[model samples]
Target: MSKWMMIILIRNREFSKDMNGLVLFCISVFVFITCNCDEEETLEGANTCIIEEKYFVSKKVVELWPMRTKSHVFCWKVPPRCTKYYIKMVPFEVEKKFPEFRNVNGCCDGYKKVGDKCEPECLKRCVNGKCTGPGECKCNLGYSGTSCDEVCAVGKWGIDCKEDCECNNAACDPISGVCKCPPGRIGKNCEIKCPRGKYGEGCLNDCLCKNEARCHPESGQCICRAGYTGTICDTPCQFGHYGEQCALECHCSNGLGCDPVSGACACPPGFTGLYCEKRCEPGRYGEHCKKFCNCHNNATCNNVNGLCICPSGYIGEKCEQICPGWSYGDNCLQTCDCNGSYCNHITGKCNCPKYWIGEKCDQKVCPDGYYGPDCNQLCHCEQTNHEANKETSVAVASSFCHKHKHKQTRSVEIKILTKEERLIFQYVKDGDYKTLANKCAQGVNMNIADINDNYQTPLHLAAKKGCVFTLLTLLGCGVNINAEDSDGNTPLHIAVADNQSHICTSLLYNEANPFIYNKSMKNAYQLAMDSEDNGIKYIFQTNRLQWYQKIRKLKKDEKKLFLYVRKGYYGSVGDLCMKGVNVLVANVEDKENTAFHFAALYAQNIVPMVFTLLNCGGDINARNVEGNTPLHFAVMVGHVDATSILLQYGANPFIENNDGMTAHNLALESSDPSLRAIFNEPLLSWYLN
Candidate 1:
C-alpha cells in the first residue's frame, strides 16, 4: 500500500481496537477497494453511493460537512438483510466520508463545489425545507416555494403554518397570527361583547350616561335623563320649566318664575310667597321681600318702588323731616300764624303765648277779667268807680276798637288821663280810631309829643303792634310817623323791623321818610333788609327806590335828553345836548348807570344817542359800580353803532374797569363782529395811546 493507505490503516487500528477482527477486516477491504479502483469507475461508484446515502442523511448533515481535504476514504456496501442494522452501526470514519463520497472527485452533478465540499445552491434560505442539489430545494409539509420561504395559506400563520388558528369571531393577523377584535368586542378571539357601561374598541371606553339612561356602546354618547339634556346629560331644564324633559311649566304667580334646576320660585319685586302671589309686608319691600323699609313716623313705603308715603307734617324718603316753617297737615298744605309761638307741625295749632288764645294766637285780651297773652293777668280796677266812669271809659275803650277787635267789653274803672296816658291807653295798647278822634275833637289830653316807656310814640306803638287801623288813625291825627324810639328806631323802622307789612305800607303811604338813618345808622329800608318777612322788605325797598328817584331828579335838559335817547328820539337828544345839559355830571339813577351807559345799553338809535351824550361832555370812559363803561355796555348789549361812535370819539379801549375787563376784552367776548373787529384793530391801540 502507498504511504497514504498505510497511515490510514494505522489510524484505523488505533480507533477500532475494541471492534471485532471481522469488522476491521471489512473496513480495510473497503479502503483498499476505494484506493485501488479505476479512477472513473471508482468515482462513478462513489457518486452512486453518495446519492444513496443522501436519502438517509438530513440536509443539516449536508450543510455541516467538513470542507477540508480527506486523507482516507471509507465506503460501505450493506447486505440486503443487514441494511437497517448496518446503517445504525456505521463506523465514524465512513460517516466522515459522506460529503466526499457525494461530491465524487469535485462536486456532484447537481451540487456546486465550495472549497473542498459540495452544496446545493438555494436562492432562498431553506426554511422548513431541505436543499436537494445545486439550486434545488425540497420543501417541508405545510411549506411552499423553491426555498420553503412561503407560508401555508392566506388564513395561516406561525412556523410553516402548521398550528391551526382559533380566532373565533375575529380576524387574525396574517403575519403574527394575533386576532383582530371588532368594535364593542374584546378578548383574544373576540368571542365576548363589551360589558355593561363599557364600550368602544376593545371595550376600553366607559359610558357617561346619567340618571339610568343608556349610551351607545360604540360611541359612548349619553342618553340623557328626563329632566336633563346635552351630550353628557349635565344641563338642566330650560327657563320657566323644570323636571323630566323640561315639559312641566312653572306655576309661579305675579309675573314671577321658577329656577330651572332646583324648581324654586323666583319672586318678582313687591311680591313674595312660594308662588310669588302675596304682596310685600308693611315694613318689607323690594324683590322677594328681601329689603327692609326705612319709612319713619308711621309712614309706609310703596311696595313696588320703596318710596315712603309720609304722614302729615313729615317729608323726605324716610319721613324724618317735619314740615318747614308754619306749614302743617298732610303734604304741608295748611298755613298757620303762630305769632312767634311754637305750633303743632301736624295740626297747625299754635302753642299760645301768655294771656293769648285763638287758633293763631291773635287774641290779645283773655276771657272775662283776664288781660295777658295766656289770659292770666287780672284787672285790679275797683268796682265802685265803674258807674261813675262808665261813659268816659266807654268812650276811651271805643276809640281802641278796630278790626280783629275784641268783641267782649270789660267793666273797668277809668282814671283821669295824663297826656302820655291819653295816647298810650287809646292808641298804643288797644287804641281805636273813634276814641282817638273823639279825644282829638274835644282837645282832651291829646298830645303828639307823648312817648311810652320805650321812647316810642303812638305811631311807633301802632306800627310795632301791626295795628293797621290805629296806625292810620295816628297818621290822621298828625302824629310823627318817623319819630325815633329809645333804640333810634323810627315808626317806619319799627314797622319794617317787626315784619309788619300793612304798617309799613301805611307809613310809606303817609309820606314816612324811609331814608332817615336812626342812631344805629340804619334807615327803614336798611332795617328792612335784616327782616325775615319778604313782604315787609318788598314794601320798604319799593318805597325807598321811589324816594331816591324823587330826590335825585334829573335836570330838565338831562331828563329830556335821556327820554329822547331812550325812546330813540335822536332829534330831541341833539336838542337837549344843545341846551347845555351837563352830561359829564355822573347823573346815574339808582342802578348807577349813566345816560351814556343807558344809551349804549338800551337805545335803538344807539349811534345818535351816544354821539349826543358824548358831544354834551358825557364821560365815555366812566364806569358804573359793575365796572361797565358806556363802551362796556355797548359791547354787552351788542350795540355796534354806539360802540363804533364811542371808539371813533377817542374812547379808551384799553382802560380796564374794577372787574379788570377793558372794553377791548369785552368786545372779544361780545356777540357783535363789528365790536370784536373794532377792538381788534390796530387803530384801537392808537386811540388808547
Candidate 2:
C-alpha cells in the first residue's frame, strides 16, 4: 500500500487503544472538562475541581512501582502533559533496609516529555510557559474574567452556574446560563425594563375603563370618563354627557353656569340660579343673588333700571349725590346763596353758570371754541371785523364773528380796518335817531324816535343779536325788516354777516331776503355755506328744524311752557316743561333758574336705580351746603335708594367737606350752606355745614 493509504488504515486502530487504557484516557478528559466549567466549594456535591499538584515524589514513585525495570523513558520534561511513559525502577529488595525502600534520589521513569531524553512519573504543573489546565478555575462570587481575572457585572451576586446564581426569580438559560426573563421582564439578568404591553409585577394587572374611555398600552385596558359605554368604556351614553363610566350628567337649564372642567352648561350675564331656571329677584341679581342696592336721601329707586332717582337736592342716579348746580350738603339739601345754574338733581356734578361753562357746555373739548378756567366763553374774533363793518351795526357783527371763529383764522374784511373806524364812530358821526338810512331798502322805515334807546328798540338789540326775530319784529311794526343801516348793509346783510347759519334758517323762515348780498357779492345763502367747519356746513345745508311745531315752540312756545310749569299745570311732565323753556335738560340750567332743583331739596326718601346713573355716570360733586354729597341730601330727606346706590358704585362718603365738613359731617353740621358753620372733623363738621 501507498504511505497515505497506510496512515489512514492505522489511524482508527491507533484511536482504539487497549480497552483499559482507552477507558482511562476518556475518564481524564471527562474530568478535565467538568472541572473547567465549575469550581465553587459551595457546589461541592456536583461541582468539579481540577488538580495540578505533584502528589508522588520521584524516589517514592520508583520504589512504589518496581514492575517495570531496565526500560529507559525518553520524553520532553519541561512540566505536565508533555511527558512519555517508559518502564524503569530499582527493585525494592535491592535496598539495604526494608524501611529504606521509600527513600532514594531515584524514580521509575515511566513518562517522558516528547522529543526529550527522559521524564519522571512526577512532573511540574506546566511545560514550557504553558500551564495546560492549572490552578483553581472559577473566581469568587464578586470576581470573574479569564482564569478569574475579572469581576462580575453589578447586581449579579453569584458564583458559577452550579452555585448561587442570583437572578431575580427569572429562570436562567441552560446553555448560555443568562436569565430567561418571563413576559414583561427585561434587562441583563432580567433586572431592567418591562415588556411593551404589560406592567406590574409579572404583568399581572389588567386596565379598566368607565364611561368615557381611552386605552393605556402597558396595561392593555381603558381609562373612562362619565356617561360612556364600551368594553373600554370609550363610548358616551345616549344624549348624556358621559363615557362608559357614566359618572356625569348634563347640568344646565335654558342658560346658566357651566362645569369648569367639562364645559357643560354656561350661564348668562345677570341671571344665576340652579340650572339657570329662575330670573333675578326683585332687587337681587347676578351670581347667587347676593348684591343688593337701595336708594337713599331724596333719590327715587327705579326697579326696572336698578338705579336710584336723585331728586332736585339729591343729584345722583342713586340720589346719594348732592344737587349739582349750586346746592350742597345733605343730598343737596343745602344751596349756596351765590346761584345761577344749580347742581344736578341726580349726581352732584357741578353746572357752572352761563358765560361760565362756555358755549355748548362741551367747550372744554372745543379746540378754540372756548378758553379759560371752567372752559367758559367762546373764542373772540379779530377786532378788524368789527371796525370794517362799523357803520353797518358793526360791533354786533364783529362780536358775533369773533365768537364764531373759534376754530380757524379766516379774514372777511374788505380792507384792513383801523380801530378809529369802529361802530362807535358811526354811532357818533350819524347820530341818526329813528331816521332811515341813505338807501331805503324794501324793509326800511324813515320815522321819528319813540322806542327804546337810540330809537332802535328791543328789535334793534335783537337785530344786534343778528336773529330773525329782530327783523321780523321790525316788519310786524311796519318798519322794513330789510332796512339798511348807516353802512348801507340791510337786515339780510346783518343776518348772514358772520356766516351764522342759524340766522339764515330763522330769517328765511320769517321774511328776511335770502337773495340779499353786500358789496362783496355774496348772498345770505352763499354766506351760510362753509368750507372748513363741518358743523357750520351741516347747519347751512341740512334741515333747520324738525317741524313747524318745533319752530313755533322755539319762538312763542318757550314762554307758554315756562308759564305752565311755573304755574304747576299738572300733566305729563313733558307736556308742561321744556329743557330751556320751562326746565333745563335734566341737570342743565335754564336762564340761571333751577326750580326743579329746589324741589328735590326737600325729599323724604330716595330711589337707587336713579342714584347710580347720576352717581357713576352723572356729575355728583356739586356743592350746596359747603360742598356736601347727595348722601347728605338723602339723609336729610330720608331717601333710601340714594344711599344704597351711591355706596354700590363706589361713592366716597369720607369726601372732604367744603367748609371743613363731609356729607356725613354736614348731617351733623347746620342745614344750609349759607347758614352752616365749620367744624374740624366730619362729625363736628356735620353739625356745622
Candidate 3:
C-alpha cells in the first residue's frame, strides 16, 4: 500500500475513502508476506551441515582408522552467507561425551563401503583395544583362538594352561580358574590325606587312636601289638617278658633266664648262661658264670663255680704257671739234668725241654748261621753268587740248590694260547705253568711249589693297561678294585702313575678304591698330585663331587649340609638348600658367624651380598646359651650395642662363666663400634660396676 494514500485517507477521516485504501493495502501486504516465507524455506532447504567426522583406530589392525558420520545435535547458528564447512572428530577408545559443533561447510570425501573402488586408507581397524572400523577385532593372549572365541579348557587356567590348575593337583576348574581337591579332602592340591581312625579337615580328633591308645603321628595308630598293650605299647611286664610279642622273660635268677618277652624259661632254673649251659654254684660266674675265675692256667674244670685247676704243667692254688720250674715232673719225683725229665713212667719217653737240640740227649745248639738238629738250620743259601737279582744258568744250576730263587723243575703239560687283544691289555695265555717270581731260601714246604696262582685278575691287567673304561668295567663285573698286579701295585696306584684322569674318573665313578694306597704307599690322589697334567688332579677333585653325590642321598640333617663357595660351589641352587647350609671357615672363628669377616674388614659391603649360608638355622645367641654369649662377643669387640638385645633375652649381663669374662669386661677391653656403644649404656652401668 502507498503510504501517501493511507495517510491521506486517515487525515480526511472519510469512511468510504479509508475503506478503499485499506483493501488495497491488504492485497499488497499479502503478496509481500508470501514471497518472504518462500525465501526463508528455500534457505533452510540448502541441506548442507557442518559435517562432523570421527575416525577410530583399530587395536587389531592399528593402521586404519574407521570413521563415524554424526552431526552435532546442538550447534551454534551460522551466518546467512555460511553454506558449507568441516569439523574433524577424531575417534578414540575414550569417546567424547559432548563435542563442540558449528554450522559450516561440506565435503565430497567420505568413507565409502568396502569393494567400492575405495582406497586402502578407507579400510578401518581397531585402535587401542577398540574397533576403529567396521570389521576389526583383537584378542588377548589366552584368547588367541579364532576371533578369541575359545578360552582355556577344564581344570585349565593361566596362559594356554587350559586344564592345568592348582586343584586336584593343579587341575583348574572348567569355568573359573579355581582349584579342586579330591573327595574327603580340601586345600590347594588336596595333598594332605585324612589319617586313619579319624576323618576331617585335618584328622584332628580324640578318637584318632583306638581303644584308649595313643597314636604315632605318622603311623596314626595306637602301639598295641600281639604281645604288647598300653597306649603307645611302651611298657613291659614287671615279672619279665615285655616286647612287641611279649616273647621275652626274666629267667635271670637261680642260674636261669627267661625269654625277653614270653616269660618262658630260656634256661632251666639252676642253669645260668645266655644259652643256659651248666648249673651255677656258689663260686660261680657273674650273674651266672657271670662270675670270673682268677686261675692263670687256661684249664678251668669248675662249672657254676669259676674256680680253675692247675693242669699238668701247672701247680699252684691259682695255677698261675709251672711251679718254679721244678716242673712237677717225674710225677714230682725229682729235678733231672740234660734239661729233661726221665720220661713217662711206663713208656720211658724222654721229655725234651725248650731250646734243646738232640732228641733224648737234650743238647743245645747256636742260633742263626748254624746247622744240626740242635737249632742248626743255617745259611744253606749258596755262598756262591750271593748277589740277588742275578740271572742263573738253567742247565747245571737245575741240580744245584741255590737257597734263594732256585728253579724247581716238574714235568707238566705246556700249551701256549694265542695272544689275545682286549680292551684292557694284550694277554699271552701260557697254559698250566705257574711261575714264582721271588722265592725264599731252602724251599721245601717253605715255597708253595704247587701253588696255582696264575696271571693276576682282570683288575690287575686293567691297571697295567691304565684303561679307565676297562678298569671301570672290570670293577662293575665285581673285579676286586684292590687286586694287585705282579708288582704288587693296586689299580689305584697304577691309575696314579699313568696320570689317566679319564680312566681315573671312570674308576672313581664306579668306586675304584681311590683311598687304598699301594705297597708303594701312593694313593690315586697322591698320584694325581705328582702328575704334570692338572686334568688328573681335576679328576680327583671332581671325584669328590661324585662321591658326595652318592653319599648326599644317604645322609640328612646337619651332616649333609654342604658348605661351599664361588667356583667350587657344587650342586647348589641360588635359593634351594636340600642339605642345610654352612660356611667353611678358618677355625670356626666364632660359633655364630660367617666368612664375611674378611669382606667386612675390607669394607666391601656393596658387593651385592648373596648369603650362600642363607638362614641356615645358624645360632644368633648360640654363645649366649653357652654363657660366652653374643653379648660377650659384642663387648669383646667394644660394641656394647648387641648387649642390650642379648640381655633383654635373658642373657645374664654378669654371667662371667664359660670364657671367664662378662659382657661388661669384654666391652671395657675392646674397641668395636657396637661394644663401645654398649659400654656407655646407662642401664648396663650397674652390671659394669
Candidate 4:
C-alpha cells in the first residue's frame, strides 16, 4: 500500500510537469523489474536510494517482472520451461521512509506468485481423482491411489473404493456390483434358487426321470414313480405282482395271471375274480362270468367252460332236446340197446315182463319144463315116453301127475307114454345099442327120459353105466348129453363119479360142460379127481393140461396187460383183447386166483379195473382155492365200492364158500353196513321167471 501510494504521488507530479517527467519514471521502474530479486540485500549508497525487485516465479524461467502495476508498461515474455509467475515491487525511497518492508523482497523456486504470496505446483497428475494439497490426490469410483492411478481391489468398488461387495462367492464388477453365479444357482448377487426342472450350477442340467418323475436338485438324480423302478423309472412290476414297489400280489384263479401295473387279473373263459379265484356261479359262466348258461330242465352248467350238464333223458349242448338213437339218459350217456328189451327212459335198464325174465327178457317163462329166473326150477310136467323099470315107472308117473295137478291149471294138457312104450331108455341104460337102435327105428322117442325119484334121464343112466355104444346111440338120437339128475349131476358128472373114461371122453367130445356144478357143488373135473380109477384120473388130468395150455398161450399174448391193468389202465385191457389176447384169459387163475381177485385186491380204483375185467369175461363168481369169489374178496378186504361193482355185475351172493359163508355173511362179518346193503339190494332177476 505505501509503495503504490508513493508511486501514485510521483506519477501525478511527473504528469503535471509534462511527458518528459513520465518517461523518466517509467525507465526507472523497468530497471528495477529487470534486476534479480532473490540476491542478498546490498546497500548501494544509503543516501543514493537504490531499489531491488522481489517476486515469485518458476525455477524454469530466467527473468521476470519485480512488480505489477496497472499503469506501468513493464513488458516480459514467459520462458519455454516456466508456465506462470508472480511479482512484487518495492520503492527505495518509500522503504527508507517506512522500514517495515526491508527484508520482504525476494523470489523462491517451484513457487508462483499471486500478488504478494507464493504457491507450490503438484509434481504428478491425479487420474480419476482430485488434488487435495501439494502433490496429494484422492481416487474416484473403482480406483485408489495417491494420484488416483490404481483400480479397486476384488470385492471392493465405488468412489473412494470404500463400498463392500456381496457376490455369493462369484465374481462381480467392482464398480457396478454385478455377480457371476456358479452352476445350479442364479439371480442377482447369485442369491435366488434355480427353477424346477433345472439343476446343477446355474440350473443347466436337465432331469432324466421317466413317467413324470422328479430329480434331485443338487445331484440331478431321477426319483422313480410308484409302480415303477430302475434309475429312470422305466421298468414295470413283475408278473403276479403289482402296485407301488411291486409288493401287492394278484389273486387270479384257474391259472389266470395279473397285469403287472394295475394288479388286475387276466381271467380265462368261464372264470372271474380279482385273481380269478371264483368260478362262474350257477347259471353263469365264461369270461368275466358274463355268459349265461343255456341249459334246460334244471340242468347245471360247467363252471369254467359254460357247458351244460344234461339231466337224464336229455341231450345237446344246452340239454334242451331228448337223447337221440338208442341213447336215452343223462348227457346221452345211457343206451337202451344194452339188452334185447326196451329200457327204462331214466335208468337205461331192460324192464322184463312178469313172466319173461333175464337181463334182457330173453328167457321165456318155464321153458323146457323149468320155471325160475334162470330157468333152473324143474317143472312137474311129465314126459310122454319112458323106459324106467316097471316097479318105479308107475310110481314115477303117478307122482308126476299128482305134482302137475296140484301145480298146474286145467287148460294145460299132459300126455303120458304107456308102460310098454318106454323101452328105448331101458335098452340104452343096459348098454343094448342094437335094441336101442331097433327101438329108435320103431318110431320110439329115443331121447325120452324116464324120471326116477332122482329125476335121472336115459343119457344119465347110460353114462353112469359106462355104456359107450349106447351113449353114442343116444347122442345120435339127439339126446341131451348134459342132462342133470335131481342132484344136479350131469351125464359128465355121472361118468366121472363112476370112473368111466370112455363115456367121459364121449361126453366131452359132444360138448359136455366140465365146469357145471351140481347140487353137491362139485364139477366133473372135481369128481374125476376124487375117483379111484387111474385111467379116469389120467383123462381128467390130460383135459386140464390142454385147458391150462390154452390159457397159458392166451396169457402169453397179454403178459404186460395185467401190469397196465394193475396201474388202472382200463383201456389197455380192451387193447389186449383187440390184439387177439383171449378175453377169457381174465378167468385164468394163478395160485388159484383169477385176475378179478388181483384187481379187487390191488387196483387203486377197483371200479374201472373190475368193470374192464368183467367186460372181458372175467368170472365174478369164480372161486379161488380158498373158495373166495371176487365178491368174497371184496367183502373180506372191506372194499365197499368193489363189492358194489361185483353185485351190479351179477356176482352170486347166495353161493356159500367152503367156509359156509356167502358174500352177505362175509359182509356182515366185516361189520360194514354199506356192503351189507349192497348184497341185500333187491335181486329181481335172481327171484322172478
lDDT of 2 by residue, 1-689 (tens): 11111111111111333333532111111100000111212212211223332322111111222232233354556442343333332223111111112222221234333332223222343221222232324444444444544444433434532444446876654334566566556666667644433454455554455433444534455555544456766555533244235555666764222443363543332245556556456554333444454667634443222345455555554566555544555546554432234445444454644443343232223233343333354555443433323233233322331231111101111222234223322332244323222212322222212222323332333444654543444344334445434344554455455555565565556655543444443444445553454554565445433211122222444454334334433221232221223332222123212223222343211222223124223334332323345555544554443443443444445555435545555445546443232222452443346
Q: Encode model 1's per-residue lDDT on 1-689: one tens digit a residue.
A: 21223223323332233322323223332222123222332332222224432212211111111122224333453432321111112333342231323333444565555544556666667887898766677776556667787766745655556655566745666446777776777788778878878889888988887666667666777766566777777777754677656667888874334766556776545677888789899987666567677888999875544557789988875889998765778877665555445578898788776645667665553344433333344544433323223223321221221113221111111244465466555555775767877655543332243433556566776877887877776566546566666677788887777788887887787788775656544567656766788887777656654543422447776666566667866545544543455554435354456777777777455544554465455677765545567888777778776787777776777666667887888888877677678776576767646
Greater-TM-score candidate between 1 and 3: 1
Q: Between candidates 2 and 3, which one is better according to lDDT? A: 3
Please give the RMSD of candidate 1 to the true structure. Answer: 33.1
lDDT of 2 at 89: 27
Name the candidate that leads on TM-score: 4
What would the C-alpha RMSD of candidate 3 be, to one decimal place? Answer: 35.4
Q: TM-score of every model?
A: 0.24, 0.20, 0.18, 0.38
Work out how many backbone clashes candidate 3 has: 55
User: Candidate 1: lDDT over CA atoms?
Assistant: 0.60
List lDDT for all candidates, in order: 0.60, 0.38, 0.40, 0.61
lDDT of 3 by residue, 1-689 (tens): 11111111111112223322431111111111100111111112222334554432212111112233334343465632433322222322211122233333333243222332322122334232222233433533333242335566655655333446666553445445556544335456666665545444345543334333445433455655434555555544433464554655454543232444555554422255455555665444322345455676465534422335445555554666563432244223333232333443323344554434343434443333443333334434443434322133221211221222112211111222222212112321221111111111121111111112333554554555665545544443334555555455666666668765566666676666554444454455556766888887787766745652321122332222323322223123112232223332122223323332221222211021112222222233333223354455545544332354445433446556355676567666665655556456676655557
Candidates in descending TM-score order: 4, 1, 2, 3
